[model samples]
Every structure is written in structure tokens, then in C-alpha cells.
Target: MSQPQPERGHMMPRRTFNRWVQNPVLEDYALRYAPKSFRRWSEWTVMNSALGGIAYMADFAIGGSVALTYGFANAITSILVVAAIIFLTGIPIAYYSAKYNIDMDLLTRGAGFGYYGSTLTSLVYASFTFIYFSLEGSVMAQALQEFFHIPLAIGYLICSLIVIPLVMFGMTALSKLQVITQPVWLVLMLGPFIAIAFKDPSAFSHWVQFGGASASGSHFSSLEFGLAAGVTLSLIAQIGEQVDYLRFMPNLSTQNRSKWWLAVMFAGPGWVILGAIKQLGGSLLASWIAPAMGSKAADEPIKMYTQAFHTVIGSGYAALALATFFVLLSQIKINVTNAYSGSLSWSNFFSRIFHSHPGRIVWLFLNVGIALGLMEAGVFGFLNTVLGFYSNLAVAWIGAVVSDLVINKGLLKISPSYIEFKRGHLYNFNPVGFGSMIIAAGVSIAAFFGAFGAVLQAYSPFLSIALAFVLAPVIALVTRGKYYIARENAFEKSDRHHEIHKHSELPNEIICASCEFEYEKVDMLYCPFHKAPICSLCCSLESQCHDMCKAEQSTH
Candidate 1:
């Protein structure tokens, strides 16, 4: 076995260090580059895991609320518009993330946000996770309250606890969980629509013209359109959730080229296609159940599903049971993803700000705890308000990223060809993305508050997207992309393997420099700390070294 080399700083002994590095399941090591050895899943498996996140009940709830408030025509039209936008923006971003094996945070840094500029984006993305986490958990809590007569507080605890163990395992365990539960969840999800179609064959016609409860009826109102757009736009950040799994896609090759592209295309922008459908379904069900459960209960996902199931199943007891089952399965599928992605966002946030990452698992718990608290405090009541406000920021951030990638990287040569995310090789802020986002957010928020009166206010979300998209390229052209990359890559001469680890390993073992642990070559990197190969986890948590070795290297 390769032995540990001595370093000047205080260090843990080899055995103790090995224990710390042993946690591959919990510590997927979000802060470091993903090594080839660690990315062993097949393309199909990775795609499945990515698709699993789409099982969230929020789609149903959002759809239901829109249908109940705006009626069928506006809800369907808004969904189609949002779906097209999400698809176009998601494609290139997903392709790049899979091609590079990096997360959205890393992708944002290279796209034009700069190093720390993307850190703000991370906070935005993290907020998406927690907010959605609370929403999904609340859905689960409602199911528990209906099925088991559990108190809402106890339901919230149960909903939060179930996802922790699943997230702790990271991608490996998450992939299996998704695959195993997907078929059941899908059947349950589609069951209602199928039953509605059969039971009331003419329901579709009635649904098509339904204009909701608005004062204007089926006629379009600019204020109503803007309000609907804002609610729909909150889903813009879901692209980050897709990239979390896209990073694990197998490298494209000649033999697997078709499958590779298909996986990327379907798993990436394809998510919104399903999302729009779910939203429409929610709207329809909310409309159907509003009379029985009242308008307030119509927006609740569990209640919506329960009424839909009751229409087909006939037996009230069986209907409640099936509805609870579907709700539970759907919440578990989505909350695990929420917790997992939140951990990655938090890991990126603290590592840059504090220059320390305890581990992804630590942040995983912290993120879940925050969501749990929100669920207990009643997240459902504020759902529309929260989502509408957040949509402005979300649209602005995504608009900046997409504009820079398509314009700055494709048309202009200002930004670097690849993403450079490491702290050592990036400016603290880049005016291009940051400035575009600020202007977009500020203007849209002002409009949302009716600064230009009710007519312009409803269209604030669209304004945010347009302003950011237009501003990003202009800012990049003016700045000439000077701040995009701080340094050229110093390790350009190294092969892929060498870039990941400093030393080629013997069959059996290698040594870690930071913590002085000995392990299989798979676990080690040629870190300069002890002048030997160090395990990946130890290298991730090492705060003192200041990235002395790869100072000039770019990260995404």
C-alpha cells in the first residue's frame, strides 16, 4: 500500500482519516470535481433518477389553483407558454452540465455569473429547494392527516423524517428508490385523468372553456394573465434539479451517441412537458372538487386527488386509501430530490463564503430541518404569495444564464469556452450576469407592485425574463468578457485521469495527503498536502491549502 507522507499542518492518523473518508453514500462531495470512478451508473439509471424529481405534488397544487382561480383557458394557455420557455432554456444548460459532469452552480459561474456572482444564484436555487420542500412536505402531511387521523405536527415530522435516510445515500440510493417507486406513482398520478375521461366523457369540453372565477369570466384580462405567469414562472429553477442528475450521465461516445443525446434531451428540457400536463390536471381537479370541499380545499393536492379517486372508485373508504397512497408515494419521490439538491446548493454556498464544507450530509439535514419548520408553520397558506414573488428572481437568474450561454459563448467570444468555478480563478463578481439580474429583478418587482398600474403589473414575470435576456448580452459586449475568467488553466497538459488525481495508482492502495490515510487508488487524489495521493473527501474539506496546486485551473 502507498503510505501517507508527512505534512506541516496538524493531521488525523491514517485509521481515523479512513473512517471520515469512508462515507461515499453520504458524502458525494459536491464541492470537488466528479471523478470518473465515482460516476459508475448507466445512462438509463441516471435519467430515471432525474425524472423521479418530477413526481412532486406541487405541480398538481399549482395546476389546481390556476384552474380554480383563472379557469381552463388561461391555465392551459399559461402552461403551454411556460413549458415552451422552460424547454428552450433547459436544453443547452442540460447538455453542457452532462458534458462537463458539473452541477448548476458550477455551470452558472462559467455561463457569465463569474465565481461569487453565481454564489448568489446558489442562494436563489437553495431557496427554491426549501420552498418546494415545504410545499411537498405539506402535501404529505395533509395525506397523513386524512388517512391516519394524525395531528398536522406529527404528520410534518413523518414527512420530513422519511426523506433524510434516502438523501443520505446520495445518488446511489436515490436512483434505486426512484426506479422502484416510479411505476406505482405514475399509475396513481394518471389514474384520475383516465377515470375522469371515462366517467364524464364530456368533462373535457366543459373544462376547455372554463374561465374560472375571475370577474371577467372567459375573457382575458392583462392583470390576470400577469398573475398567472408569475405563479407558473416559479418553476424556472427546476432546471437546477434536472442538472443535479445530468452531471452523472455517461460521457457521450460514438457507440452510445444516440442514447446519450436522447437521454439528455428527454431528461433535460423534457421535464417541463410533463410538468405542464400535471399543472393542467391540477387545475381541472381543483375545479371539479371546489363545490364539495370549498375553494380553500380545492388547491390542496391531497384533497384534489381524493375527489378524483372517489369519482372512479365509488367507495369512499377505498378512495381515501388510494388517494393517501398516491400522495405518500409522490411526496417521497419529490422530497428526497428536494433534500438532496438543497444540500448541494448549501454546500456550494458555505464553501465559498466560509471556505469550508463540513460535508454534503451536514447541509442535507440543515436544509431538511428548515423545510420541516416551514411545513409546521403552515406553508400552504402562503404558497401563492411566495411563489409569485420568487418567480421574478428565478426568471431573471435563468434569463441571464441562458442569454450568456447562447449569446456570449456562442455568438461573442467574450466569456471563456468552459465554466471556471473554483474560488482561486474567478472574480468575486461579474457585472454581466449580476447587473442583468439586478435590473431585471428590480424592474419586474416594481411592475409586480403595480408601479405602472394593474395592467402592466400582471406581466411582470415576462418582463423579468425579457429584460434579463436583453441585458446579459449587452453587458457582456460592453465588458468584453474581461471578468469571466481570472486565470488560464495550469493543468492543460495533464490527461483526464491525471487532472482528477495526481498519481496513477497501483492495483491495491494509495495514500491521502491531508489526513494521511491509506486507501485504494479509487479513493485518493495526488494532493500536494503531504506530497502524496490523498483521498477525495479529505481534499474537499481541507480549508488551509488555498488551492495552491490548481490555482490557475477552471472548475465547471
Candidate 2:
């Protein structure tokens, strides 16, 4: 019998693919590696956009809530501790992500979690982005309700819809928005402190000893401290947002290595440093205003900013305007980031599971839709409960990643020196990262339900981190890193070199056989399908080929 030949087509089917990848502007290349050619933005612009994500006023609201529930001392200590941990852990994550042009979802696939293993983490990360998006959007809705008498439902829709257009242009529009809004946000952020410092300095002194709503009336209780830490740890997934922009940082050059490292440090782990300070500021402000506004109102971000505005501009219309300006600016700044990161996360999730990617814009609407649904369901009322519960999963995933980077890579030498994320080279499941995350999450969730008694139960989130960190290295040692990669390198040496070239020197264009679009050489890859290089979008949506290039090596 004659040998059979593979079916041939000039392009992949459009019916099975998404519109976002078909349209470059809408796709934003979220799921795949960020080619050198696409990374044309200056480091300052990328850093500003990443930093803009920190503009979320919810951190203040969270701080205020913790202070009111756990006492000032526990809230302050918890903020500082979580900040330190986030900063230290984020360093390696950001460094690898930028150097390799991979986001956290892709990075996980190489760092011990295999392709499928990391997909679980992608779901966890996607959930984090949307959950927080809903929380932050709810705050914006409340502000709208107070200022304009807009119904909460309508405000929620407005808040969710506004971010879609901003994200449509992807990094291009995002970078500009972040840079323009940064100065204004800083001024408004600092204005309140300046007013308080000058107008009623004694108010700060009174706030220092305020124990808030704690029955114990002391900040140093171990139980309260543990509970507070659980709530604060929920923000651990934020490193995912930092990595989104870090992937676009200009490659390190001999002349600019120092500046490059500085930018990464300041924009990466350094975000938590600023976050902790803001949390503390919020705690103090909330305590000072609690008496006048009533305890419930004081814990709300809107009221906290409103009081600060009153301190400076005095009561009535002027105060309301200042308050509204601060709230609106802060919301826009953070929500853009929330929506952007959420879209990337959803892209990561659906692409791997379904073996198809529609484009980042499709996921943008999907993320916003999920968030909007949560808002309509009244997510704000369950904020503490939701955050506390989510902390367990967030800590496990982060801890596993950190353990692989710090311990598996550093101490055990089990992980690769560089991140290997191309679909052609990774295992479907690496026991080290996958095992550790599962074990840690399992134990922590048990403790969270009082399985280990009140103290351990209260500190379950912290326990999850510690357990995952210890377990990741142990799993790597046991497995001997056999499952980390399916194949060492699939691309030819010449192709590898082509992948690393700077955008200007590389050929300006190539035609994707699948989509029939002319893209830059950097945007196209040599696919075995159609016997030509195709755009990453086409590669993602090309289900007919069934990844024939890696089929032999694929664990799946």
C-alpha cells in the first residue's frame, strides 16, 4: 500500500478560531510569548502602566476593614508582613518573566508545573483578577451612587464597560493612559495626608492607640494577627499583573543593565512597599474619621476620601468635588489594570483547555461580564469572606512558583536555569510544582475550616505558603526534574537566533498562510503546518494540525 500524506491547506479554518487573533489590535498577543519586535515601548511607559495598577483604592478599603475588625496593631503588622513576602517573592517572578518575555501563566508551565498543571493555576489567577475586578468596580459603583444618584446596577455596568475600550488597543493604549494619569493620581493620593498634617495634626496622635472594633482592645493578639494575615495574603496573585508589563521591558543590554534592573525592582516587588504604606495611611485615616461618620461608613473607601477632602476643602460641595475626583481617578487607574490582566488570564485559561484562542478582546468582555455579574449579586457584602477563602488558593500557587524559583532553581538545581515555555518543549504535568500546590492548598483549606484548631485555622493562608515552599523542593528532589521538559529544543539553531533579533534588524514582514495577513517576521513562527511560518494567532487556532510538530514528544 502507498504511504498516506497529511491533508493540506493554505490557511487554518476561520470558523474554529476567534476574531481577536484575526485582528492584531484586539488580540494583544496575551497567551503567547512576547516577541522582541512587539516590545517597542520604553521601559518607563511599561513601568508606569504596571504601577498604575496599584492605584486601586480597595487596598485602602481592605486596610480599613482589617483595622476595624482586628485592631490597629494586627492590621498594621499583617500589612507589613504580607508586603515583605510579596516583595521578596515577586523579584524572581518578575525577573524571569521580563527576561524571557513570558507571563506568569507561561512561566508556570516551565517552572515545574507542566502545560496542563499550569492550566489549573491559570484558572486560579483568572478567578483572582475578576474577583478583585468586581470588588474594585463595586467601589466605583458606590461612588457613582453617592455623587450622581446613579443606581448601583447602572453604575456597575458603566464601570465594567468603560475599561473595554481602553483595553481594546492593548498595551499601546494602556501605556499612554497609565502615564497621563500617574501624576494626577499621585497628587490626589497625597493631598489628603498633607491636609490632615497641617489642619489637625493631633488627629494622628489620637489614631495611634485606637484599637477599633476588637473586643480585646489590643493590637497584639495572636489570633487577630493570624486572621488579619489571611485577609492580606489574598493579594498575593498581584504578581501576575506586574509580570504582564514586565514581559515588555526592553531586553537587558550591557549599557542599560543597571537601569533595567532598577526598573524591574521598583516596578516589580517594590509595588508592595508602596502598597503597605498606603494601607497604613488608610488605617490611620479610617480611625480618625470613624467617630464622625459612624464605624460602618469609616471603613468604606468613599467615606475615607470624603473625610480627607473635607479636611482640606471644608464641608459641602467643594469637599464632594474633591472626593469624587479622587475616587474617579483612582478607580479608572486600577480598573484598567484589572480588566487588562483579567483578559490575559482568561486567554491563558481558554487557549490551553480548548486548544483555541479567540483573542484577548473576547476574553476582556468575558472577564468584565463575570465581574459585572458578581457586582449585581452584591459581592461587596461578602468581601472579607471571599478574600479570606481565596487566600488559601492564592498562597499555594504563589508559594509553589516561589519555591521552584528560589529553592528548586537555587538550592536543588532541579529546575532549568532559564525558563523554557515554548509549547514544543514542556511536559504535560511536572510533579514538583503540581504536587506541591495541590498538597499545600489541600492542607490549608482543611486548617481554614478549623481542622487544626483556632490558631492554625486563623493562620491557614500563611501555613499554605510555608507548606508549598517546603514541598516544592521536596517534590523536585524526588522526581529528579524528569518531567520539567518534554523535549530540550525543537526549533533549529537558525530559527532560535531569528527569535532573538531586535525588531528593526529583522525582516519587516511575512505572510501567514493560515490568516493570509502580512505580519512582521517577529510576529510569525515557522510552523510545520502548511510548511511555512505563521502568526502566533494562527498557530494557536490551528486545530487541524494537532500540534504535529510536538505530537511525538507531547505527554498529552
Candidate 3:
């Protein structure tokens, strides 16, 4: 754990941006890295919280939506292929953020997008949270309507507001909520499946026989498969939420070698393995119930779970109660994460644009408010269309980031091995990530809108992925990786370079002129504009200063 260094001199007291984000319990270092002291939880504890968000019943809803729109075979294959892509792409992102001890936003700032460029991706990521938040909240509202007869509109408000306090204290409260409820969620989730399997041995065969209404019965179309895959692919952004917890993992070492790898594997890319299973489960449950519940009801978690639970509990009211409880558990568990990650994304987005941050909590309400509006506007009804269009952008962003990590950083050496996320060291935009994302998303969205043809439209996700993968390196080579970095060795040139820590020695302190606050030696910088030391956070939010700190020629 790194200790805070107290300094001899302090500046005139003004509000510190860091102060807005410095809660030992609540803030969870939203604006900075998760140093060793704050990352005190065991690997398993973090893993549980990370996996808890997967409790969202939307996987079932999405799978069913895709299966209904397409067919069983295509839906299953799409879920599997998308899961493989998500898991593979997630590996480098999860590993980098965890090892570097930075959040997803900070990682984005370094991974070829630069400081402000990542702001666009921040909005993209924030949208993912709210869109999913509304979807999950709608499912919960349905549960409320089922068990309590709560109006859907009122239910939406109740669902949105319920998660606010749980997330205000950050991961401290969230981690516990997930851990405590996980056992019951698991049992309630599995009990119905087991009961159903034992009761009807031929049910699985029946599920395979049932094709969607629009389909040639029991046949698979390439179009159906592509649409199914595109819808499922929107979930690529789930890795960002996983990275939120992964960043808190204690630094890996030889002492905890096995545990470290286990944590990274399961909490990182391993999340998709479970996601795939849940999608399949949703598809099966929907396939069996679609005939009885109407096709639309198969798209609702409350309905699907209730039908399954009835098979187990054998009483209508009792089954409804149990299913509603499971839905609430799943929704609350995931909504908290949605709220938390949305807060972080909004913080990054507004702070960069506005040059100041009110705090992450402010954005929390804003995010929920937007999601609430969407729920009222019936975003859930258009789930397929919304997610299908949204996946083009989502895949574009993730594909760009992944391509940079695997191709540019690994093969081309067009980017750095280590992440340098500080604002002064990054350009406003890097063509490698920014350009590729736009081009990929543009093409995919065009196809999604039926610009190319029916076949290409269905395969829009693959087109987005392919273009992003190809363009990242091509742009890096064309630009010669110039915009990828602002100033070479800029951190070393800063006033308070990192000092080697020794057990017997006290660390140095430096004060920021703008905020007049003390920071550890490594956090301070010599601001060329202010002509005095400034901490990284202040330097980051300093708009008037521009890039004056690095406003010089670079022969390096």
C-alpha cells in the first residue's frame, strides 16, 4: 500500500476536485487508480461481486428476443459466437486495467484514444449502462406488476430509485449486496430448470422442434443467424462492468500465483462463459413457453421464470411470489452495477467536457433519470431494434480497443506496452482508435439501416468487427502513431517524478497550485501555465491551460 505524504507547505484553500472523489468507503477512487491499500479485498470477494451483475435476467430476455425474431439454431449459435468474441476481446482489457490499477475510462484514455477522444467512448459506454438499466428495470417492474399489482409506470420509478443508496457508498455496499443474495439467486434460478428437466424428459427435444413464427419451421437462415448474433453482440460492453471490479484486484505476485490467475481468468473473460449458459437457458425456457405464453411473453423474464417456477412450486401464487423475488434480486443486483458504472462513465464524460466535476454521485442520479425516461417511453418494447442498432456502435468501440491491444501494441509496436493515461501525455484524439471506431460504426449502422442489403444488414456485427480490426492498424501505420502520444517522457519531465519507496524512508509531498492541496510526490506536476506544481486531477481538468505543459517541439 502506498502511504500519503504530508508536505511542509500548503497553498490557499480552494475546493479540490480530488475531494469530490476521495471517500475511503464511498468513492472507490472513481477519478484515479485503485492503489494497494484500497484493493484490500480477497480475490474471491471481488470475483463474487463481478459475477453478481450477471444475475440480470436480460440475458434470458435478449436470447428469447433473438430466438423469437430468428430461430432456435441461429439464436444458440449466435450466443455462442458472440460469447467467444466477448471472452477473447475481454482478456487484454481486463488484464491491463487490473494490472495497471486503473478503471475502464482511464484505460481508454491510454489505449490509443487519448484524453478527450476517450470522452466519446465514455458517452458510448454510458449509453450502454442506461439502456441496459432501463431494460432490467422494466423486467423488475413486470415482476412488481405480477406479484404486487404495481402499475408499470410507478414500478419503473420504484425500480430506478431503489438502487441509488445501495450504490452511493460504492463497491463497499455493492459487493456485500451481491455476496449475500448470490446463494438464493443461484438456487431459485436453478430449481426450476432441474424440476422441469426431471418432469418432462422430452422437453429438450420439443424445444429444438419449435422454430419462430416468421421462420420456415425448424429451418435456419443466414439472415436469422446474423440478426441473432448482432443483437447478442451488443453485450460486448459487459466487459467494461467486469473491468470495474477487476481494477480492484490486488497486484498479482508469485506469493498468490494460483489465486491471482484464477481471479483474472474467472472475473475477467470467464464471465462470458456463464453469460453463454444463461443465454442458452433463456432460449430453452422461451422455446418451451412461447407456445403457451404468446411469443411476446417469452421476451419477458417475469413470465418465463414464473412459468418455470410453477412447475417447481406447484401453486400459482407461491410460484409467482418466488419468481418475483428472484426477479427483484436479479434486478437490484444488476441495477446497482448499472448505476455505478454509469456514474463513472458520466463523470469521465462531463469532467473532460465541462472542465470540472461535481462528483460521481451527481451523475448517478442523472444516469438513472435518463434511464427512467426511457422506460416511460417504452424502450423495452423496442428492445430488439434498440440493441441491434446500438450493437453497431458498441462493437465498433470494443473492436477498436481490442484491435489496438492485440495488433498495434502486440504486433505493430505502434503503441506503447504500458498505459500512460495522464492528460498531458496524450493527444486530443488518436486516429487509430477514434477513426476506426467511427468508420466501423458508420458502416455497420449503414448496413443495419438496410443501406447495403438484407444479407449484409444481418451480418452487420461481423462487418463492424472486421472493419475495426483492419482499420486500427492501417490508421496507426498511416499516421505513423504520431497522435497516439502527445509528448514523449512527459511524466519524467514533470516536477515530482516518482521516488523509489523504501520501508525505512518517508516519501516526498508536492502541492498543487490550482487547488492548493497536497498530493503524494508521484501525483504532482509542474504546470507550465500556473508556474507552480499541480496535481494530476487539477491538471486533467484545467481547460484554460490547454496543452501548454507540452506546447513544444518533439524531436524524440
Candidate 4:
């Protein structure tokens, strides 16, 4: 049953792409390795761009909404608890992605999920982008409605369309945009807090006791705390967007080790620290304005900050204008990232299923168009219901990935130490990670719908995390790690047992036989079907070959 070896001298016909796919600046290596040469930005610039997306106003709304529902003690306790978990889980994922220069989708492919297995996660990630895009866009529209007396429907279109040009250029434009606005953003973000603290120092004392609509009042309730935490846990997928930028980090070296680590830690998971603070601050402002603006109005950042600035600035019109300006700036900064990351996720998903890529630009419009529709449909009106339901799925996906990194690879040493993402090298399915996520998400979603009980329903997201974390390593052990790799890598044929880490030590450039383009050696795989070397992207887009390389290898 053994198959014949590939003909050594034969070459298959090559494939071609349009100008958009060929351009490095616009494409930004959407579905392949971000080679060392393309990662030309300094550590500081990359870190800033990665952190820019954290400026979203959704935190403000989420915090205010949760606090208004669950009271002060439960809301504050839940935010801190979820922030700690997010910070801890973010570290290893961020470190590995930066070290290997692969985006989250590629990392999922090699970490434990096999080639096609990660398509589900890609869809999950793409959903995160558009859902949050709609949420953030809704915040911007609310600001426009308040300031200009415009209809929410028209404002939605304006908010969604403005970021298209800014994000079309990919990292090249995003880097500059993030760096230029960061300083002003920091000042504007903190100004209201400082003014509120100095003007009415006693406001903090009153904030602790003001309960909007919670049955528990100022006291904590475990059930209410769990519900609040579930809403905040939906932010777990924000790390994927962080990894999209972290993949552009330059190779780690002794000279830049300290700077690199700092950037990764802060820009990666450290985002939650600021995010948690913004949430608590939003809670505080919501309390201050609830008496005047009513409970529902308190959740809107535009309304919350406008009243906060009234204490600092004398003119009512000036305060409204400043708050409007801040909201627009924050939304533009984050929506660009949302739109950009969504495009990358959709590209990863469809390119695998269809074996064709029109380019990242085509997906960008699709992602934005979906978000625009959601915004017009008023996605923000049902914020708590939407996010609580989504947290079950998001937490499960993250939990499975983290378990693979920290347990299977680092502890048990069952999975490959280095990432192996090339299509030719990976199997189509691996139950270790993908199966764990499906089981966990399914169980937790059932609990969310009260399959277990009221307490478990309130804490369904925790169940998802626990199940995924425990299941990944157990499944890997039971499967005997057979599904991790389909065949020994063929590119380093001098030693059939060579590890992929050695590929990074080899020469950088190799011209792919399928595309006739020079790609880094790490992204190129030996193709048995073509009897030549091929780049990962080119290999992914190949449909006629039917993965003949892995098929031939498995026969042995």
C-alpha cells in the first residue's frame, strides 16, 4: 500500500494573484508567517498600535450596565476577578505569538488544533470582531445623536464608513494612527477623572452606596457577581486582536529582550488593566450622573462623560463638544482595528474552506458591511443579553488554546515545542484542542440556558473555562498524540527527524515553486504533488493537489 515518492525534477504550474495580494503593505501577510524582514517597526511602535484598540468605549457601557443591574459590590468584584484571569491567560498566548511571528489563527493551527480544525475558531474570532464593531459603532452613533440631534440610523452609517480608508492600508497606516493619537487620548481619557476627584472629593464616598436597580442594593450576592463576571469575560477574545499586531514584533534577541518582553506583556494582556480601570471609572461616573440623566442614560459614555466634564468646564456647550470629540476619536481608533482584524479572520476561514483568496481587502468590506447591518438593527440595545450568551463560547475557545500552550506543550511535552503551521505538514483534524472547545462550549451554553440550575446558569462561563482547561490535556493523553503531526517534515530532508525550530536557523529566502515568489524558509514546505517547494499561502490555495503530500507520507 506504500505510495510512490514524488518525482524529484518535475515542477507543477504556478498560481498568480492580483496586485492587491502581491503588495506587502496592504496584504500584511494576512494568512502566512510575518517574516522577519517585513517586521521593520520598532518595538515601541508595534506595542502602541497593538494597544490602540483598547480605547473602545464598550468597556464604559459594559461596566455601567453591569453595575446598574448587579449593584456596586458585585460589579466591582466581578470586574477585578475577570481582569486577573484575562491577564494571566494572555501571557503565554502573547509570548508564543510574538516569538514565532504568527497570528492567532496560525497559532491555533499548530498549538493543538490541526489545519482544518481551526476553521471553527476562525469563525468564532471573526464574530468577535464584528460584534464588537457593532457595539463600538453604536457608541459613536449615540454621541452623534446627542450632539447633532441626528437620527441613530443615519449616525450608524457614518460611524461604520469613516474607518474604511484608515484601515485599508493595514499596519502601515495603523502604526502611525495609534502613535499620533496615543498622547492626546491619554490626556482626554484621564481629564474627567482628575476633575471629578478634585472638585468633589466626597463623590467617591457616595458612589459606593448608590444602587441603580439591583435587588441586592449595596451588598454583594454571589449569583449577581457571577452574572456580572460572565458579561466581562466576553472580552477574552480581545487578546486575538492583540496577537494580530504582536505577530509583527521583531525576532527576540539578547539586546532587545527586556524591551520586547515589556511590550508584549503590556500591550498584550496588560490591556485589561486599563480596561478594568475604565470599567470602574464608568461605574463611578454612571453613579454620579444617574440622579440627573436617569438609569438608562447612564450607560452611554457620551452622556456619562458630558456630565463629568460639566464640573470641569464652565460652558455647557463646550463640555458637550469635548465629550463628542473624545467619543469620535476613541471610536475611530478602535473600529479601524475591529475592521482590520475581522478581515484577517474571514480570510483565514474562507481560504481554507474554498481554497481561494481574492485578497484581504475583499473580506474587509464583508466584515464592515455585516457590522453596519447589526448597528442599524440596534445591537447595542440588547448588550447584556448578547455578551452574556457570547461569553460561553469565547471563554471556551480561549481556555482550550491556553491549556494546549501551558499544559500539553510546556508541561506534558506531548505537542510540538515549536509551532508547525504549514498546510502540507499538519493534519486536517486534531481532537486535542478542537474537540475540547466544542464539548466545553456546548455544555456551558446548555448551562446558560438553565440545563443545570440557576447558580450554574449564572456561572456558565466558568464551567466552559474549567471544562476546556481540563479536557485538552486529557484528550491529548488518550489519543496518544498521534493526531499532532501527520508526517515528518520533508523540507529538512538531510535528517528526517529534524525539528521545525531548525528551519528558522536556515537561510531566510526560498522561491516557492507554486507562486514563484520568494518567501522565508519557515513558510515554505516541500510539496510532493508538485515535486517542488511551495509557500504556505500558495499551498493553502491549492485545491487540485488534494493534500497528496500528507497522503503519501501516511502510507509509510
Query: What lDDT, from 0 to 1, does candidate 4 have?
Result: 0.90
Best by lDDT: 4
Off by over 4 Å in 3: 1-20, 489-513, 516-524, 553-556
Residue-wise lDDT of candidate 3 within 1-556, one digit each (tens)? Answer: 2233334233444546445466657667676656555677888998899999889989989988877777777888899989999999999998887777678888888787888889989999999999999999999999999899999999999999999999999889989999999998999888888999998657689778768763656577778889888889999999999989988887666577699778878988899998888888888888888889889788899999898998897999888899999999999999999999999899888878888877888899999999999999999999888999899999999889998988898999988777767777788888889889999999999999899999999999889988998999999999988887677543354322212211113335556577765555445555656666667678778877668756753533
Candidate 3, position 414, lDDT: 84
lDDT of 4 at 316: 91
TM-score of 3: 0.93
Clashing pairs in 3: none
What TM-score fits each model? 0.89, 0.91, 0.93, 0.96
lDDT score, candidate 1: 0.80
Total backbone collisions for each predicted model: 6, 0, 0, 0
Alpha carbon lDDT of each predicted model = 0.80, 0.81, 0.83, 0.90
The candidates, ranked best first by TM-score, are 4, 3, 2, 1
Model 3 C-alpha lDDT versus the unseen true structure: 0.83
In candidate 1 the C-alpha lDDT for residue 189 amounts to 89
Best by TM-score: 4
- Name the lDDT value of residue 348 in candidate 1: 88
Weakest 10 consecutive residues, lDDT, candidate 4? 495-504
